[model samples]
Target chain A: MERIPILKLHDLLLVTIQVDMHDRLAMTLQDDLMHQIRRTRARGVLIDISALDLVDSFIGRLIGEIASMARVMDAETVLVGMQPAVAITLVELGLSLGGVRTALNVERGMQLLREGSPEEEASGHASIDH
Target chain B: MPASTIERLQVACEEDLVRVRQRVRTMAAEIGLSLVNQTKIVTAASELARNMLKYGGGGETEFERVERNGLIGLQLTFRDSGPGIENIEMAMTDGYTTGGGMGLGLSGSKRLVNDFAIQSAPGQGTTVTVIRWK
Candidate 1:
């Protein structure tokens, strides 16, 4: 089986998961990713899902949970490069990411992370500064 | 034989998921969907089957072939006599799962298919229908 690759860049973590698209693997990876986020105290995370062909409810929930856990650890989680079909399917299923952020690609996600600080957003400074 | 047919599948908790997967896969393939679409349908069925076993108190799944606008499609209905959802709106909301379900099961399954519907009332059981077109 192909492994999901995790790469650390600057203060962001990039995870390139192979398209196993299996619920069990997705859940396990979600757990592992959460652990990594907590351990590294990273500021941002970009999950590349361009390779996945399918994502069910279980995997979607795992992603949502990862986002929530990342938030508690003061990290921002961004899902990037989701296929159009996958996006449509996720919407049709009525699955929402709660507050997890999403971007079209990793570059955009990283840019978003760099542009804003947790204090600026949390303290309402960015909103006011803009 | 009619162009479309509906068959009632037995419910046996988690064991029923295997049957649901097999039946949905066969139906999805028969409709000429691509491998990706087939996988989506199978995943949807698995999620629903697990839900049926976990919350719906185990019921029946109905598989049918449908045609609309000259296109062939696969339709599935899951019905259970378990405790019905007290709040359909809340139940459909993401992150509002009462059971251990990842809370994405219903919504995610809805996304995988072309048409989705859910009907439930407290003490009246629950029914979910999903359709996929080729």
Candidate 2:
């Protein structure tokens, strides 16, 4: 079985999708990411899709699902590095990726995660202690 | 005007959908389509191909380089032999799906391309043809 490697960077889980993914691969990634978030207690996930030139409805739905799932799991997901062409097409395809956070690049996405991380605030300290 | 055949491939599974997208992108680029146009056509191809696989039990896709007057464009035709759609109008409606999907395949793909056409009956198969001009 093929899998997309998920890397833990400090308090964030990073996934860069470089290959053209099949339906099964996308579903697997969604499941695996949720497991990793629970296992590592990661606060944020950054999915870089810079290499992908096309994002159809299926892939678009999966990304939205992953983001929503991470939210329910107490994690933030920031999709990063979407090409301009893909952006244009996705909107026309009638999938605006509502309720999903997006960043121009990885650096900005990481910055967003850091700012939004629950561990940064004093109130968050109480939750981390549990 | 008569269209020139670019390529044709079978869409039998998930892997074939990926191949269809890649080949459509390559063919779109070869015809000097802009980046946005190329992306739009490829995305449309992906949606239609997947629809054929899930609803039509897989099918065939044909690509063509079409010229109407002085404008050049790319056209795709998806044909599948499965339980055909009974009501295309309802099927094309957004958020309407028989399969467990987002239901953006038909309506959304139509928005992504310039021209869209569909032919299907109760027992017969379905054929979708779309074109995006550069």
Best by DockQ: 2
**lDDT by residue (tens digit), candidate 2, A1-130:** 9999999988889999999999999999999999999999998999999999889899999999999999998888999999999999999888999989999999999888776744556555222321
What TM-score do all the candidates reach, one by one? Answer: 0.64, 0.94
What tens-digit string does per-residue lDDT give for candidate 1 at B1-134? 35566888977755467667778888888889877677777778878877887898888999998887888788899999989999888877766788877686777677677898999999999999998888
For residue A24, give model 1's deviation from the true position in Å: 4.2
In candidate 2 chain A, what residue range of length 10 has the lowest lDDT sum? A121-130
State the RMSD for candidate 2: 2.6
Clash pairs detected, candidate 1: A89-B111, A92-B110, A92-B111, A93-B107, A93-B110, A93-B111
Model 1 TM-score?
Answer: 0.64
Top candidate on TM-score is 2
Cα lDDT tens digits, model 2, B1-134, are: 66365678999989999899889988999989999999999999999999999989999999999998899999999999988999999999999998999999999999999999999998899999999999
lDDT of 1 at B69: 82
List pairs with backbone clashes in candidate 2: none
